[model samples]
Target: MDKIKIRGLEIWAKHGVFPEENVLGQKFVISADLYTNTRSAGKSDDLTQSIHYGEVCQFMKTFMEEHTYQLIETVAEKLAEELLLVFEHLQGIRLEIAKPWAPVGLPLDTVSVEISRFWHRAYLALGSNLGDKEAYLRQGIQGLQDRKDCRVTAVSSFLRTAPYGGVAQDDFLNACLELDTLLTPEELLDVMHEIEQEAGRERLIHWGPRTLDLDIIFYDDIVYDTPELHIPHIDMQNRDFVLNPLAELCPAYRHPLLKKTVEELKNALTEPEEAHAK
Candidate 1:
């Protein structure tokens, strides 16, 4: 919500497509806008409460000088990742890498590449219905945690639920997890698929029994849908298994499409069953 700007910091780094450019370094002007909450730091007058811009500058300089890349785009991309990783206080960053020395024979001052990268909050629904279902679910969480680009922030207590989709299978262990990740939606899906494969999950049957099932329930209140994936997880409001776990971890987390909080959805789904039993 607050901004700390670092502009026009110059550095010399070896990064270019040409062989000679790699051998001979060039001047690169780096700029970054670090985003975070600085209110506590400002009020307390404590350096520990906020990000240190001076340290960030030194880190940028050292990182650029150490790594060699073929394109300024690569430099910006990799540098953004590095900065976000190094500074735990930084939630997002806008980075620019400018190459002033152009090999072009024409008159040109410089060329640059800029990128905006941030840690995205994502909610994941995890389920398993095969042998050692709890083990599969735990393994899936560990796999996500192992990735450098992903951080598991919170986890809901696991719930036992009857299988959905009319599949004749064992009871499922279901839960929701909160994560902070730098990966894009598709990239995160790929990671989930990898975990599923590791758990020996098969996709032969649609909505059928599986060793593990991981679905992206939410990504920063974003409404996204593609042929391969859908955000708000298509009819999640109707599934008690999904909502119950979500309510445990984040009852206030609202569904962007449904416009209902997790607690509301969970209550709406359960109230009718409760009345029926009464």
Candidate 2:
């Protein structure tokens, strides 16, 4: 990726934990590294083809003046997200917020917070066993694509798969999709649930049957777990119904937890009864 850097740009902002800090604004130094492809601009010698540092500086100036936050950490995070949102071509950003004059009586040049944020690639498994199955799946895909912070990159062919759990109502039409999203894992889950609701999915049983089902199969190289969601989906590797279609789209995708490629998982699927056996 090509580089666009803004180093130590001074600004006056009211940001701190103390009440006085908010009343009396202090000096802040901001720096950012924006990443994007510059090949086109370089080859064509066209300024329009590349990110304009001047414009970015102006935007930063305006943004700083407009917003007030209690912590520099919030400022850094907001700026990183804002930059990525404004610049469609930018892939990632490293942001730093330096406070040279902190209230603490310490002999230090400056105190700063630095963070890096970027877009993530995620694969989602879609299935519907009840109602108009294909309609529900297609609606789910459209909902994901319509989300503000996400883009659906690819969709695989739908296939017939036996019910995952013991309560066999009927086979399901299953497919996989790839997405480029700026949302975190939890945010992605929220969006999935919203899509399911739009599809009128009624959760009567645990994998029993549903109008629509959306599960996160992979999320970049990140591994996350909570009471609500898990990345690299817990049972995806053992199910051919999930691994097969996923492999068709991204054979190189490695499960963060298992550390194995998708193709390997697909090849390792024993038989139809394996899901039940496990």
lDDT of 2 by residue, 1-278 (tens): 77788898998878898999888889999898888889999999998888888888888888878898888889888888888878867889888889999988879999999999998889999999888899999999999888767889999999998887688589999999999998889988998998898788888788788888999988988788899998879888877788878988999877777777898777777655576798
TM-scores of the models, in the given order?
A: 0.98, 0.81
Best by lDDT: 1
TM-score of 1: 0.98
Error of 1 at 59 (Å): 0.5
lDDT of 1 by residue, 1-278 (tens): 89899999999989999988888898999888999999999999999989999999999999988989998899999999988998979999999888888687788888889899999999999999999999999999999999999999999999999989887878999999999999999999999999999999999988798999999999988888899999979978988999998998899988887788999999999999999999
Error of 2 at 48 (Å): 4.5
Identify the candidate with maximal TM-score: 1
Give all candidates' CA lDDT scores.
0.92, 0.87
Clashing pairs in 2: none
- lDDT for 224 in candidate 2 is 83
